[model samples]
Target chain A: EADIYQTPRYLVIGTGKKITLECSQTMGHDKMYWYQQDPGMELHLIHYSYGVNSTEKGDLSSESTVSRIRTEHFPLTLESARPSHTSQYLCASSAMDRNTEAFFGQGTRLTVV
Target chain B: AQSVAQPEDQVNVAEGNPLTVKCTYSVSGNPYLFWYVQYPNRGLQFLLKYITGDNLVKGSYGFEAEFNKSQTSFHLKKPSALVSDSALYFCAVRAKAAGNKLTFGGGTRVLVKP
Candidate 1:
């Protein structure tokens, strides 16, 4: 039983191609986050949204953009994919409470050739 | 800046043995601590958290964590290690002033060999 879902669990695309990674949660959480991780490495925050139409850049610099049009959906898009964009993208959501922990979705592994 | 530290990159333990994964954190005020486990190619699963309560917090899969305020540590422990317990563990921390953002430590891979 997965509360959060990510589409195209694995993806391979050519350079300059635009790709959108979809993440949807059924938990009705208000806060969502995007993290990028390489193999056997730490996860880096890239983007986050507190609610619909409220998005902010995270600690890491990313060419990808995200949109939160609905409470349950937060999708990340790479405007122009490059070789460096190859990595795993993870999505997480948490409750409005400050003490609550965030729940993560099975990541999307992207490879830009 | 709120940060979490998992000093050991890998921890090896034999089955039926007590296991511990160490974690320490730094934050301005009282800290909200959490532990998550990640299996191969899977998203992280929350194991336990320490918002405020007893120092010993129990969580899923027979895991427990001890929150030490003076030492600023929350170490995950299991009474007996199992081969199935082999996975990557992450420590996270968040301060009240940091909004909802959680800063994560570099993961520690735990290998429980039979």
Candidate 2:
């Protein structure tokens, strides 16, 4: 089984609320990524981290910010959630080896009302 | 720009029948292609990938894919389908000229009827 885990399998909150999605991996991977997906839609990369203290925004624009304070943790935070932000958030991690496949978490489904 | 395209939005097949999900790609250099499956309310799981070597590559869950350089396509195939195989499949590509970032297709939903 994949070691990556995402907390709050489902969440529903009103607009303007602050929220955080947690992601952690025990695989000792250096690369971590966050992706957003609407139901039945393709996943869009939102944020990624190369290692502890290193983060980068992905191709898609997102209001959420992520922090990589430790190798095992990469959490995404939304300062103010909105209805448009409601979606499924997925977390993944992979070894630095080129061509290696990534392991993914079950995902967190967020609904901002 | 590097991109991956899964032309079909959905595919249906009866159990025990063969199945194929089409995918085509465009990249500046040699493509690193991958296939992933996502069950309802879950994240994507890696099914297979074609990095190099032979055009045919076998992967997890009795799945296989063929890489056709001439066609610039990588299509997922299964000899016999199972009802439990129903899920959402995604095709992704990363160009050698590009970085490690992967560009994913819209996705294809597979429905296997018993």
Candidate 3:
């Protein structure tokens, strides 16, 4: 089984609340990524980090920010959640090598009311 | 920029029948392709990847993919799909020189009937 875990499997909150989604992997992977996906839809890459202190925005623009202070932990924070920001957030990790496939967490589904 | 495409939005097949999902990608230089499966409200699970070597790569759950470098395609297939295999499948691509970010295609929903 994949060791990656995302906390708060489901979250429902008010529009203006601040929220942080936690992602951690026991696999000690160097590359971590956060993707936004609607149910049964395409996945849009929002944020990814090559290693500690290295984060880059993905193909799609996103309002949330991510920090990779630790190799095993990559957290995404939304300053002020809005209804538009509600979606399924997936966290994945992969080794430094390009040949390896990424492992995903169970995902965090957020709903802003 | 690297991108992937899944032509079919949905594919239906009877149980114990052959299954195929089409995928095509574009990338500068060589490409690293991958296939992932998602079951309902869950995160994507890695199915398989084609980095190099053989054109046919086998992965989890009796799934396999064929990489056609000339056509820039990696299509997933199963000899006999089961009802439990029904799910959403995604195709992704990463270029060798494009860092480690993966570009995913629009998913394809697969339905297997018993």
lDDT, candidate 2, B1-114, per-residue tens = 788889999999999999999999999878889999999888899999999999999999999999999999999999999999999999998765766777789999999999
Write the residue-wise lDDT of candidate 3 on B1-114 in tens digits.
Answer: 788999999999999999999999989988889999999878899999999899999999999999998888999999999999999999998877677578899999999999
| lDDT per residue as tens, model 2, A16-42 | 999999999999999999999977688
Which of the two candidates, 2 or 3, achieves a greater TM-score against the reference? Answer: 3
The i-RMS of candidate 3 is 1.0
Worst 10 residues of 2 chain A by lDDT: A94-103
Please estimate how well model 3 matches the true structure, expressed as its whole-model Cα lDDT: 0.94
lDDT of 3 by residue, A1-113 (tens): 79999999999999999999999999989999999997658899999999999999988899999999999999999999999998999999999888788999999999999
What C-alpha root-mean-square deviation, in Å, does candidate 1 show against the real structure?
A: 0.9
* Clash count for each candidate, listed in order shown: 0, 0, 0
- Interface DockQ per candidate: 0.85, 0.73, 0.84
Model 2 segments more than 4 A misplaced: none
Between 1 and 3, whose DockQ is larger? 1
What are the clashing pairs of model 3?
Answer: none
Which ranges in model 1 have alpha carbons more than 4 Å from their true place? none
Best prediction by DockQ: 1
Q: What is the lDDT of residue B75 in candidate 1?
A: 98
Residue A17 in candidate 1 has what lDDT? 96
